[model samples]
Target: PYPQHHQQRQEIFFGNGLTANYQARLRYMIARYAHYDHILAWEVFNEIDLTQAADEQLVSWTEAALDFLAEHDPYQRLRTVSWLRERWPEMLALPNLTLLQVHRYIPHLEHVGPSDSDVIAAMLSDVIHLRHAQRPFIFMEVGHHGHDDSDVPGNHLDRSGVALLQKSWAGFLLGGAGTGMSWWWDSWLEDNDLWRLYAPMQRAFSLIQWDDPGLRPMPVDLGSDMRILGWQSSRQALIWPHSRWSSWHNQLLQPGNNPHLGKRFAVTLQSMSPGRRYSQLAIHMRSGAVVAAHTLHADGHGRLQLKLPPYDGSIVLIITPQP
Candidate 1:
């Protein structure tokens, strides 16, 4: 009754009975489907570590699969595979497997709620712990369980789509290759009409020089229980001040606590050049519109305080050199 049974995995990857047939099938599928522009990448396998195959066979198969893709996939969509977060360090060395991915879930091995800290920390730790990959990393699959497909059966309680957005923002801001890839698109996402949520990420990212090599995570003090995270280059910074004040319990669960909604925030940005004039632009994430524009010069310790506009969910602050 199990979907991805251990014997089936072994057969698919190495048991030799179906290995050649599987490769031929993959080639046929690629030739027919690889030309679609929307198809991002070919994932070699999903959570292959969960299979019964030995480590050596998994690595060998990954290498061979990647080679197979390179030979056949002329369109050359990117390549990735998922592990259950650091289960196979050996797989990271496959140079042709250009992306690293982890499937993160709450209560996997720890007791945690779906609080801001819980969801954010779960993915954030992936970015931090998988730092050695030296390749683009992403949370390839995330939800409340080992399997998140709603078509089957079970309760994955993100009724309001708050967790999805939070994880997306957190994944991107924390140096991931893309937003946290949630697993419930057919159910929660389409059901709630939450496709509009992408506007925030798209607009904010449009204004950021995110590819700059000099960008590194910077410390910030927002003077409250805010999730203050920023990455800075010598001349600019992108800061996200996320409120843990009322989002999870209120917006996601109860859906009535709006007191912390639309509250303005004051922030102290650290790790800047002292006395340098900078122009600040605030991205009101709801509308993806720029608000709270101002200019400020950093103090002696390379800190600058700026009052960001009132926003219910969160706001993005971009600091750049004054012209």
Candidate 2:
């Protein structure tokens, strides 16, 4: 409901007796702003399913709008629209939509759980689903609910900030085009002083050369409960692991009783060059610090198994081969 000057409060939805006017407004927006080089993408609408329209109508409306944007936008910025989890299949089918976008929250609407493991497991499942998208995928909204939840204790900061941070890193390493974008940016993040969490993520991602064409998703086997996600090029690999049981909210809510912290485990790397000895294997904290390094050898079948150090939460493993 932005552009309050012209937008009717109740007319945001498509097929709401104002389709013509909405189309005209969209035309005006493209003509006005499509020339801006910094504009990343054009989102047709946010959470269109919330309109409660029939699925057929929504899909038709989405296709038409996507067609208009595709034909008119001079720069052809990435086209995307957000959808509830149930409507994801329809959204993915839109021919002109260049980027896949999904909206998810902790204690999901259908499957609610405040448990740290439950939340991570759910989020990871969603990420796995998005892997089928031909184009890049992104989690458009991720965070704890802005409203008070009777199931969890403490304010949003104590309850959701750490979970937000954890999910962001998880989404990024799990092949998301970008980290999960937190909703309620002003009130939930900045006001609560949780904005500082982005610093470490920024540093960690900066080490990656995203433009390298060889970088592609790679398989990682950390066994059950523990998950490993990674991408590899011929020269290097980036691996990230997460424990299903650890969460910041749990740590804060119960200081002495945190069972998920400080655990050691072996992670196996697959699809490596068989019988090749990698020059360096470095483990990095999410804050972008190198905690450990090793020279490792892959087995005959192109797998390498390494025992990781004991630590709370998640860590990134970077493997590099001699040139």
Candidate closest to the true structure, highest lDDT: 1
TM-score for each candidate, following the candidate numbering: 0.79, 0.81
Model 2 lDDT tens row, 1-323: 44463224433555453377778988999989989988778888888777676777678788888888899887889998887754467768889999887666765333434643355556666766667777898877877653544333333435337766766776677688888887767666666677777876776666666777888875434355676666777556777666645654455544555554677778777777788777543544435577777888888988877657785665677776644
TM-score of 1: 0.79
Model 2 reaches what TM-score against the true structure? 0.81
Error of 2 at 64 (Å): 0.7
Model 2 pairs in collision: none
- The regions of model 1 sitting more than 4 angstroms off are 1-12, 16-18, 33-37, 107-117, 144-158, 217-225, 243-266, 309-313
Q: After superposition, how far is residue 184 of candidate 1 from its true place, in Å?
A: 1.4
- Can you write out model 1's per-residue Cα lDDT over 112-203, one digit (the tens) per residue? 45543345554565667566567777777765453445332212455556666776777777777787787767776787676787887887
Clashing pairs in 1: 262-312
